[model samples]
Target: MCRWLAYLGEPLRPSTIVLDANNSIVAQSLDSSLGAETVNGDGFGFGWYPTDAPAGTEPALFHSTEPAWNDQNLRELTRAILSPLFFTHVRAAAAPPIQQTNCHPFRYENWMFMHNGAIGGWHKVKRDLTLAIDPSLYPNVLGTTDSEVLFHLALTLGLADDPVAAVGRAIRTVESVGHEHDVQFPWQGTIAVSDGQRVWAFRYSSQGRTRSLFHSADVPTLREMYPDAERLRLFGDEAHLVVSEPLSEMPGVWVEVPESTAAILEPGGYRHEPFLAD
Candidate 1:
């Protein structure tokens, strides 16, 4: 499993959540509370949209094969950058070699994606899924992990046109392939994606018990309820985060995403909907 986060709403310091939270992404690298691995040190990556970059400009990215907790460059970079929508992930290699390409938060044009669980029996089902991908997008499959293939499959199905529908179709296809291969519950994970505007997070598994996912309530709601608390000031007005696990122990601050659910986050706020199958 991996530990990841998708942030939207305000463009402040990237490190504000990556390094500032009580149990920050870096902290989770060594002490994740919900991940099966407990320690996610395989590698790490960060993607963020710059405030001044042009519309088609690609988000800035930094990745390393080293454990995130020990990556000096990661520390140097996150603290110095800022963006409205960003994603950070720490990987726990799932039977693959530890390499930069194996890291999460894979990118394609304006899209960035990350996953926290494995595709059951990926080895057995790899052939069918790989052959099912669109050849035009097949070159983008740089890694052997199920995650990269899944991203491209979503891209193939129509992620850019309609993210929710595209992903739903992609997953359904994955399930069909999985069932044919006799790989029960072939899908497992919490997924997060953003195009530098609206961020979408999903919690789903072929089985009912999926990986853990949570999102913070709106900042205004918290500030209104806490009045004079100085802690509220730590997060900017539009600050919001959705993660594989709670970044802190702040009460009334986090809500667990229901199984087979999806959430969209933007400047307006978070909107959640059941992840119904198409």
Candidate 2:
């Protein structure tokens, strides 16, 4: 398993969420309270859209095989960059080699993606699944992690056309292929994807017992609840975060995304919709 955080809303330094929160992404990397694995030390990656970059500009990426907590560069870089939307992932390699290419927060065009779980029986289904990716898109598949394959698989199925539907279709296909290989539980993960604007976070597994996933309470709601909390004041009302675990233990600050569902976060607000695998 892995841990990741997706942020959208105000233009702020990446370090604010990646490092400043009580149980920030950096903290989660070393001491994850809700992850299946306590320490996600394989590698880490960060992807962020430039605040001043022109429209359609792809997000910048920084990946390292070094552990998040042990990397001085990661700390220096996160504090220096500011972005309206960004993704940071601390990986726990299941079977893939711990190389920079296998880091999370994979990118394509103007989109960025990261995942926090695994594809069950990946070895049994790897060949078939890899062959299923559209050849035109397959060349872009640079890493060997099942997480990266899942991204391209979604792309082949039409992620650009419709994120939710494409990912659902991809998972459906993975399970179908898994069943053919006699794998009982074929899919298990929470996914976060962005196209330089809105973000879509998903919670699903073929068996209906997905990993832990949560999103911050709406900014206005958090404001009313904690009027004096200086941290809440730093963010604009539209600020939102979809994380593998609550960034902080503050009461009423986080809400668990229901099993088999998706949350779409855009400028004005966000909405939750059922995410079905079938």
Candidate 3:
């Protein structure tokens, strides 16, 4: 449905992955090889934590209804800013209207969230899901997309306490509500969330067949595998990325995240754990 990526590691310009890579996120916005829609031109969003900001500072965000490939400001901003952690998402609007509020990389305080899938039969269960959000947090819901609702739902269910469990609970809520409306496969998405420190990405769906998700291999390992590759020299050993699709065609560069799994990227490296497990 959409293409997105999350980066955590050394501080570097956002453009390195968003624009300068072989098949950058901007390129995916216009011609995604694996997305359900080839052109995700409805809108785009970028969020990043400033390298110099104090700990727990909120990440800055830039959103536009313009196509990612055609946005001049996006080009300039990504080039100028360097961040240790960031998120970029290009939207392919399904049933929602094309507007800035609906863009991805949705934020709440110091946290950022984005998604690359949809809730089946969203209209049938929209009311129930929205009403389930905690009233205190409900006021912060600024968009109509199921993605934003899912974020707030996670927050209400305790995203601040435990992201993995909160997200699991949120998806379960969506599945439960959708089942009441006869929508068989209610939840489908590869979601990424961060609290300005570590990133937690989940790949899951109610039907068991989920969207594509991958994380980059550790930099030291990549360096040893491809010693002569110039691109490999640019990143620090701590660099890691989790994306909807591989950013490059280099062999051994990206590893496919398993179905029903949560890939967590932290300072040292990354790891995978079963998500929504019984």
Candidate 4:
């Protein structure tokens, strides 16, 4: 269990959302109204593509085991950095220990991954899932989190070629393995994966109920709805964000992600498609 946000749009400081929003990621770290746990203080991490990088280049990363609010370095990095696409996550420590390596927004080449759910009865299913990962990728795992293992499974299943299919396969395997071990609820909660350009976010669970996730409308639309809200004035038209909860309380500002669906965001716009178990 964790809380995460993915931003894609015109360049802006990370703090604009992480620390400056009405109910910022920092605020959610302490009082996440919709999360299973209110305080995700185990650890935190962030990744952003450098402004100087070539169009297709990868991102730079900074991670720490300290709580987001308790780490001065995060604040320092937040103030000095800006990105059109970035991921920030606060950990609640599900199976994964409180360490820098176990933090979300785990990176591999140009790809970055994070999750807000746990593999049910992980201890029982861990071995089977670990063996499913190609030995080549198995060693890349630096932490014991179910989230990171899931990412490796996706990679082994060809995440770079087709993220949707790769993740779907991984989910299939997770459910398959869990059932063999007599574990229920093999999958749960929301997920986000990106290659520093496009983002794929999914909401799903075995029981047809998933975690709380929402995304903001375009900045122009939000501005019209909250004309007097100063916070809405900071972002450009390209600004878009997918969050675990509404960052602002204003009406018509955020739309909930449908259960059993995946949302994709890119510079062009947003798209939603049904997500089904494999």
Candidate 5:
């Protein structure tokens, strides 16, 4: 339903991928070839962990109801800030109202979460799903989007204690509740989450037909392959990215994240594991 991207590794200006990539997240906001909607102009958000911030600090957030391409403030801020990790999403309102709080990259403490799919029959599932969130976290549910609810549910189920397991538990809970309501495939989308130091990206849908998600190859390997590419040469070995769509057409630069899987990004490297509802 939308497009998003995350970056980890070297400290770089957010615009490097959010605005300057060949098919940048800003470009995808207007002309996404793979997203369910071609133009996701309803709203957008940016969350980044400042390079100079103390460890475990929450990311700073910037959101707007304006389209990414039309927001001069976005350009100004992205160009000015340098971050070790960040998230940016351009939204296409599904069943939710067009408001700034409904944007992606929702934050909770040190973690930031974003999604690019809907929970099928959300109106039917919303109440039950929302009631599952931890009472303390319930107040943080400032938005009405299913994506935001999913983040809270995961937190309630233990996202902070163990992200992968908690996400799996949350999805299972969603599926179980959806099935009870006669909705066959309750979960449908990809999710990206991070805690400043590492990121976790997932590709899953009840029907096995999910949106696009890809992560960049190791910087050193990609650098050797495209020695002349300035973008490739500019990054250090620890740089890594996970995006809703390929940022460029460069072969071997990006690898599609496997279906039904979660890919983890860290300064050391990347890892993939099957993502199941149960």
Candidate 6:
């Protein structure tokens, strides 16, 4: 299992969430209270779209095999950059070896992706799933983790045209391939994807149970609820976050994404839609 977060809305420093929050992503990497594994020390990755970059510019990436809390460079970089949308992931290796290529927030052109779950029976279904990726897109598959493969699989299945549909199809493919190998619950995870503008987050599994996933309450709502809290003053009304777990214990500040749902965050705000995996 892993822990990750996606942010959209106002332009702000990535460090505000990745490093500075009460239970920041970096803190989660070291001691996650809600993650399946408390220590996600395999590696970490951060991807962000520059605040004022030209349209279609791909998000910048920084990956390290070192644990997030132990990486000095990660500290320096996150503190230096500001982005309107960004992704940060802290990983805990299940079966794959820890390496930079295996880190999350994998990128393709203007799109970025990260995941916080696994494809059950990865070793049994790895070959079939890898071969199923479109031949043209297969060339871009750079890591051995199921996370990166799933990202390319989503791309091959048409993520660019319709991300929710593409991801649902990708999970179905994984489930079908897994069942062929006698793996009953083949998919388990929460996923986040972005095209440098909007963000799409999904929480689902082949089985009924899925990992924890939540999004921040609307900024205006938070402001009204915690009017005297100084931290609420840092964000614009449009600011939003989709994370594997709450970044803070503040009441009414995070909303749990319902099971089998896709949460989409765009310019106006965010909305939830049923995610059909079949």
| TM-scores for the candidates | 0.96, 0.98, 0.99, 0.96, 0.98, 0.98
Report the C-alpha lDDT of model 3 over 96-211, residue by residue, as the tens digit: 99988999999999989999999999999999999999999898899899999999999999999999999999999999999999999999999999999999999999988899
Model 5: lDDT of residue 243 = 94
Error of 6 at 242 (Å): 0.7
TM-score of 3: 0.99
> Against the hidden true structure, what lDDT does model 2 obtain?
0.92
For each candidate in the order shown, give its overall lDDT on alpha carbons: 0.85, 0.92, 0.94, 0.87, 0.92, 0.93
Among these predictions, the greatest TM-score belongs to 3
Clashing pairs in 5: none
* Clash counts for the predictions, in order: 0, 0, 0, 0, 0, 0
Off by over 4 Å in 5: none
**lDDT score of model 4?**
0.87
**In model 3, how large is the Cα lDDT of residue 116?**
93
lDDT of 6 at 83: 88
- Regions more than 4 Å wrong, model 1: none
lDDT of 2 by residue, 116-200 (tens): 8888999999999999999999999998999889999999999999999999999999999999999999999999998898899
How many clashing residue pairs are found in candidate 2? 0
lDDT of 4 by residue, 1-278 (tens): 67999998888899999998889998888889989999999988889987656666777888988888888888888889878889999989866668888988888889989899889889999988998889988778998888999999999999999888888889889989998988878888788998878899998887677889998887887777778878777787888899998887877888898998889988867889888844
